[model samples]
Target: MKSLVSSEIVEPYAQALMSVAKTHNLADRFGDEVRALVSALEGSADLSQFLANPFIKVADKKAVLQRIVGDESHPFLRNFLMLLVDKGRILFIEGIGKQYLALLRELNQTVLAEVVSAVELNDAQKESVKQRVQNITGARSVDLQTTIDPDLIGGVIIKVGSQIIDASLRGQLRRIGVRLAA
Candidate 1:
């Protein structure tokens, strides 16, 4: 129920931010700023708690945001941050930023692929995985996020959305074991 309420608050704010980004042709810039803001919020429990504190004055919150965003931030985003402060929605900024990025990826026809392999992939291997993901998802671009998992023994596992492509050695062995058991 709390998650449902949070999403209800998050989605409209994210959509509103996306609408502004689209209107000003600043989607990429806004996405970058939002990502940075979300990173800050996540990295600093103090900052997150400060923003969420009801006793904190709105002016102080805005001032902190200004310092964090710097003076050169676009007026629209500056105003957006101020609006969040005023509405007491600043606490949800991280969720809003994440949702906005998801919307941006959708707009750009990009897919995020989480790839786990037994070893670090070289550029060539990374590109191959990305190209394969593109072919599978029909996305214009693929945002390949890679991780190393030695337990896989060899090969890679590609996960996109709810689909999982397990090309790893351990997965193959598990499948073979299942077949033998049957």
Candidate 2:
């Protein structure tokens, strides 16, 4: 069950839901709702347990999810939840939400950029990094996630989608070493 809950397995489901949301012109709303659902699952251990417990019947889990999400929940999301309950994939909901958001960003021409630096970045530095990523990726906007890794020694490494720009001192030194060995 755990192995089956990976992003690869969950992506098709997210893609299907994204199609429905996009067709109905509710992509943003559905994206927000999915994020909220993920947040709820993270915030409530009991709720997460209940959703992932196979011993609980599917009907019962669907009812509970309906109550939790309320009557006003988006139809696409509500039906999507029921489908997950039916398919015994409740545990993969978080991955589905993450995948859905990634799809949404792609659809909107935005990109998620990861920046790893030797030291903590100030607000200005972070903004500059984000702007550079946006320009390089041709993304309308860049959602940046920053991390500090002293091993980097200096400079930063940026990752946007499938591409990586490694400017870190560690990477440079490693490249130099490899060239010298050759």
Candidate 3:
């Protein structure tokens, strides 16, 4: 599959970046930078397409990166961006950033939990979800990402890695329907 190949290419680049972050004792800083870069890529389809366009010149891509990252970014990260451009692997930036963040989470013993609810959760509810995730994964901490989906009607769904714990009212109704049919 395309994703299999992407992962193959992405892992090494992410690990290499992680190695550099560890060497500089800037794992957290690099993680933040990667998150920001990924956010930017996701926020702008044109920018993402521009970086991935094979017809675009490398210098142009590098210039765009320089402009986006600016001179304030660490020299290592700036060089890393240039290296990706030079190697014609800029298309994998999003995947590489995600993989790098995953690696950082592993190193830090934290789990990323995606929570979907019918309504926005308050601080107390978020803390409760975090505690539940920590209990489920046995991680020292949980990075909670919350989203609202009103179709759920009520309750919440928690996803950590491949695991999904669906407590939504719709899920419950579906299960009940299946049970009655069976």
Per-residue C-alpha lDDT of model 3 across residues 89-134, encoded as one tens digit per residue: 9999999999999999999999999999999999999999999998
Q: In candidate 2, what are the lDDT values of residues 82-148, reduced to their tens digit?
A: 9999988887887888889889988888899889999999999989998888778787888777889
For all predictions, the C-alpha RMSD in Å is: 2.4, 3.9, 1.5
Query: Candidate 3 — what's its lDDT?
Result: 0.94
lDDT, candidate 2, equals 0.88
Better of 1 and 3 by TM-score: 3
How many steric clashes between backbone atoms does each model show?
0, 0, 0
TM-scores of all candidate predictions against the true structure: 0.83, 0.71, 0.93
Using TM-score as the measure, the top candidate is 3
Instruction: List residue ranges in candidate 2 displaced over 4 A.
Output: 1-9, 36-50, 57-75, 118-120, 148-150, 176-182
Q: Output the lDDT of residue 118, model 3.
A: 99
The window of 10 residues in a row where model 3 has the poorest summed lDDT is 68-77
